[model samples]
Target: MKQLFDSVRVGRHALRNRLVMAPMTRSRAQFDGTPGDLAATYYAQRASVGLIVTEGTQPCADGQGYLTTPGIYTDAHVAGWKRVVDAVHAKGGRLFIQLMHAGRMSHPDNTPHHRAGVAPSAIAPGSGMFTAKGMQDIPVPRALSTEEVRATVADFAHAARRAIEAGADGVEIHGANAYLVQQFLAPSANVRTDEYGGSIENRARFAIEVATAIAKEIGADRTAIRLSPGMALWGIDEGEQGPALYRYLVTALDKLGLAYLHIAHQGDEALLADIRARWTGTLMVNRAGRAREQVGADVASGVADLESYGAMVLANPDFVERIKTDAPMNEPRREGFFGGTAQFYTDYPTLG
Candidate 1:
């Protein structure tokens, strides 16, 4: 059995352990899309983890879906993240920046340009997004032209390059949740008749292209992607063939030689098993609400090479130390999970 504290190799980096710090959206970036100053301290505080996947970051200006979320597209954005990268590296941590585009799950007020959102089709996600004013209904997004789709693919590649320039160990394409990539994956959200939609291959095309482009920009050994098979959040429904779609998608992506496949498991044990069987590389599994006692269960069973934790790592700065010593963890406060000062963000005390 692989213990949670055991050292592991993920892609081109040698991780200290098999515990990964999962990506979470913390609305702490500057209005200009730069990361908060304390972002470095916040991430460095949790550097004891084997791998640290930074918060969801927009790849372009229009990719913004929530106010104060970080971006990696601008020179200022790169400078801001460089500090975070240096901080984590000083603490001997490996970090991966998660590149995300919110798609139709966005509000005009949330973006600086106040432009209409873009997706495979001009469909509304039928959900609300957090804006400066408040939670606002998502508007109908404009359909991306085939050329624009190609351009957006380039944007992801550029972002990956920028992340590496900023000193990040790697980049993780956010193909999960209700983000842009998954928006294209979901049938209900992507009703286009173009080569990027309709059939399973079409729906999966955008994701595959984004991953391929990133891997090309940065080495495949430093490129990874996080996926949520059958995720239906914010009006995203992959339909009845969701399982088959993932099986096909995972198989295709696996051949790309990506560093790792981080799956935010949505409770399909059978499908997860199938994915484990198809993927020959490193697998990072994030089982929602996974208990402390089950931390290394997947790794022990050979189902996953690593396990990712969001809230647990957020509340426990000494998460790796605590797990190794069997110490009690501080409960994460929900109210402080989003935007806030160091009060809850980096003030979580570690065992002294």
Candidate 2:
């Protein structure tokens, strides 16, 4: 059986263990979208993990969603993230910034300029987003023109470069979670007939272009992508074409020869096995909401190169040690999961 402590090579970085800290949105950045001081300490605490994927950070102003999320397109943002990178690096950890474009899942009140959300099509996500005025129904987003779409791709490339400048090991395009890339992939959210919409090939085009551009900017080995196949979250559904869409999408991305492909497995072992076969490079699997006892099974069976945990790592700074010795885990505070300060963000205790 493959052991969780076995060393693994994920692209250009050599990991000491097979434990990964999954990218999670904690909404702890400044209102201007810059990472705050406590952010560095929070990430540094969990540096024992082989790999740490930072929370979903907006690649551009229009990409902002929810309250106080961080960004990577500005100088201030870069400097803020640099602190975080330094902290994690000092503790002997590798960090990858997850560049996430919220698309239509954004609210104007959540951003500095209070800009309207942008999407492939002028469709609403059929949900509410937390804003300055509290939770409000998402509005119909303005459709991006062909030129604007190219600009958005450039934004992702720019953010990837900034992440590298901020001392990150690599970058992971957040193509899942009903965000911009996933919005285009889902038929219900994307109603455009242009090159960026319609057919599966077209829907997957944006994500491919973004990934290719980022890879070109900072080598293919330093680029990665996170995808949640068959996930029907936040009223974003791909309908009857979900499985085929991901199969086609994953196969296309596989040829890029980028870094590891992080998969948020949603209870589909057979499909995951199929994905593992389809994808040739390293694979990081996260069984969302799985019990602690089942965490290492994916790695043990050779189904995944690494395993990631969210709530476990969120509550336990010394997650790897806790897992290694079967120590007690701190219960995650639901209320402090978002829009919180040090209490839930950086105060999680380490094994003494």
Candidate 3:
């Protein structure tokens, strides 16, 4: 199992270890959607991890669904992210920017222009989102026209280019959680009878297109995607077709030869193994809320090429060291998980 800590090739990059810092939403960017100064320091501090995936950053203004989330569309956003990438690189860390587009999970109050949200269909998600006025029921989002859908995919391609220009090692398309891409994949949220809905192939089309566009813009070697199969979070229900939908989606994406496929492990060991059998490239698995003792099991068992950690990495900047030496980890502060200063973001102590 010690081999799990050894270096391995993932896509075009050779990581020094199999530990990865998972993308986490800290809500610490500027109100203008630019990454703040502390963001660089925060990421740089955790450079010990083999790879660091930055918090979910919107690809465009309308793509933002939460307050203070970063964007990659503007020159300013690129410049801000450049600082972060430079810092991480300086510390000998490889970084990937997770390009996320929040769909109907948005409130106009959270965005700068206060624009209404957009999704595959005009659905409200039947949930509440955090806004300046506190949590409010999400409004029914505007359904993107077929042309707009293509435009959105182009936006992802543009963001991937911008992320490369900003010095990131790669870009991870956020197709997980209850975000824009997942909304389209979930039957409960997407009721469109158009070409983008109805069948598993149709529902998976948007994600496939976005991934293909980004992979084309950058090489497939510099593109990655994250998926959460069987996820039922925030009113997202992919229904009985969830498993089959993911199987088709994974198989289709496998043909693209993306940098890696990051999966948020959702039980079902056999299904996870099935996905691994189908996908031929690097795989990174994140077992959400997993115990510290179980950290490297996925990599050790060959279920994944790398293992990703969220809160543990958040509270323990020296997570790699902690794992190696079996050191105690600082408990993550729930209050500072979202909007906060450097206290929970970067002030965690490393073992002396």
User: How does each model score on lDDT?
Assistant: 0.93, 0.91, 0.92
Candidate 3 Cα outliers beyond 4 Å, as residue runs: none
lDDT of 3 by residue, 1-352 (tens): 6455798777788888989999999999999989987999999999989999999999998899999999998999999999999999999999999999998888999988898899998878888888889889989899999889999999999999999999999999999999999999999988888889999999999999999999999999999999999889888999988999999999999999999999998897877998999999999999989998888888878899999999999999998998899989999998999987887888988898
Which runs in model 2 stand beyond 4 Å of their true positions?
none
* lDDT assessment of candidate 2: 0.91
lDDT of model number 1: 0.93
Return the candidate ranking by TM-score, descending: 1, 3, 2
Q: How many backbone clashes does candidate 1 have?
A: 0
* Residue clash pairs of candidate 2: none
Provide the TM-score for each candidate, comma-separated: 0.99, 0.98, 0.98
Ranking by lDDT: 1, 3, 2
RMSD of 3: 1.0
lDDT of 1 by residue, 44-139 (tens): 999999999999999998788888899999999999999999999999999999999988878889888999899889989887877778788888
